[model samples]
Target: MFTARRLSMVAAITAFALMAGCASQNPYDPNTQAPAEGGVSKTAKYGALGALAGAVAGAAIDHNNRGKGALIGAAAVGAAAAGYGYYADKQEAELRRQMEGTGVQVERQGDDIKLIMPGNITFATDSANIAPSFYTPLNNLANSFKQFNQNSIEIIGYTDSTGSRQHNMDLSQRRAQSVATYLTSQGVDGGRVSTRGMGPDQPVASNGTADGRAQNRRVEVNLRALPGAQGATSTVQ
Candidate 1:
């Protein structure tokens, strides 16, 4: 007769095997720059881990009815894990759809989403004003931000190492502020938005060449879910 402890151990091992064996089926690879086309979602991975832990706990606690306890435990914990990532996952997917072909890149890093906007499309040379052509895209972004109100937005501006450090710093600050202001004007909650200036630091590419300098001069918008807003949803469409 298999003991309750042994049964639980077997369950854990099986789940682990499934998780590992299905690696190729996992959609979100933190190492890659692009989203996978077809695979198990990251939320499922978390649920699997949760189920494993829950099964062990449930079996250990309910000696009289270990199997039933394990089932209930796995269901509860797995559901919680799946729900935890739902908000961000949905938001990321929507943002990707929203930003398609707009020259902005939507990247998922853990639970956070980042939007990278190149300098040429965002701003004019040495100017804090936003380019006229970018307004529509900014409007679209503001709409999405308004829909995903649970997130705190941070806009960071970067400049090429072409000018004095202090000057670049100020320019970056102004550029970031400009974006923030525009978003707020579009009815995005100003309270959730903040801006910073990196001042020619954290270059995405070498500044020695014109192409690299162009790439380096840009802005990044990072969205992180507020602690209290986990699993929260908005009615905005």
Candidate 2:
């Protein structure tokens, strides 16, 4: 007989496989939301896949009563979905508490969490090096990230339109990588993290004025939960 833990692992793996096969684009990418073929949300589609996987796992696990095993497997997956939501909520609350008074602003959007960190606090002008003062907050963030280890992290760096586009892009990439390096050095899983540089793009404010330019040169960290709370988080390595 298969253990419940083994069944859950199988279900998660199967659901992810189904999602990856069905969508040409990445379903778990934070930058894009791929449309479903029949108006079904990705979550719903994956939920159904998980159910199917559970049914299959349950049947295989229970030799004498396959039907009963299938039902139990599906129920277990449903429960895991609910559990994921609960943990997500707790993680958001903990992040908000930890980031309070730290120059970082935590914003929750749907199932995703965004952290905006101003450039002045994160680095010196035209430099990719992290400011010494910012280390404490980054450390705190690393602790929270380790505690809530199921979410994939995306660190995006941006810059004002001051220098050549190529220069800005390289600087931005270095800045993003700097943050990623610090987090991983603090024991956060490196495999769960990715970084991108969007130089002089998607500015939150106008670049004409000093204040607007200040706002434009900043970094954003986005956290997106992976499927199945019981499964370890994995993303681009």
Candidate 3:
């Protein structure tokens, strides 16, 4: 008898086939709807097929992890943190434009931008190595950071709570380190970048389901303001 993991793997393969069929009949849509009055209009910057394909670590898409959706269009910059906000906004716009149709989402969180890379595509089956297919996306991201050349970069790695703590945590650390290494290799300042591994911690979805597990195994790149620099691009390492 096939285990749940095996069953989920089969299901994922099916989803890919179905997705291809769907794409053949229709273009990938972000499925954006008009914003409510005085509210942000949610726009999914990533392509539908890619996102579906990426998240299906071997199961259907987990809607619960997608969040309320991304805020579309340029957000108004406030007076208090106008400089940081504007900088972040421009970076966000550039990232979204660059990563369009890549199944990678660029979202705004207050004064920062969160680049969410689905783990299914990012790493392969408990491996810390970044998949070849994922390199282009990371390269594009590195280029964007180079262009912006400001703010601190924090790469956080996550994993589903399946394996032992030591093993999972080690895997997470290596994954985060791998991303940081890639960015610095692309000429992003090393000192401005840091890596953290949060294995099985702060899960965005339940671990009971395969879809949720796939969603939980993710890497988040957070761009934040440099301490005391007040959003200035300080050359560090």
The candidate scoring highest on TM-score is: 1
Tens digit per residue, CA lDDT, model 2, 35-128: 3346443344544566676778777888887667777776666444334433554566677778778888877665677999987688878889
The Cα RMSD in angstroms, rounded to one decimal, for candidate 2 relative to the true structure is 9.7
Clashes of 1: 0
**What ranking of all candidate models by TM-score puts the best one first?**
1, 2, 3
**What C-alpha lDDT values do all the predictions have?**
0.76, 0.73, 0.64
Report the lDDT tens digits of candidate 1 across residue range 1-237: 457677856487547633642443233434444433245555656667767767667766777887777767776665555443556676776777777777888888767889999887898889999998678779999999887788899999999999899999999999999999999999999999999999899999999998888788899999997777653333433
Q: For residue 174, what is the lDDT in candidate 1?
A: 98
Models ranked on lDDT: 1, 2, 3
Root mean square deviation (Cα) for candidate 1: 4.4
Better of 1 and 2 by TM-score: 1
RMSD of each: 4.4, 9.7, 20.3
Give every collision pair in model 3.
Answer: none
Model 2 has an lDDT value of 0.73
Off by over 4 Å in 2: 1-78, 227-237
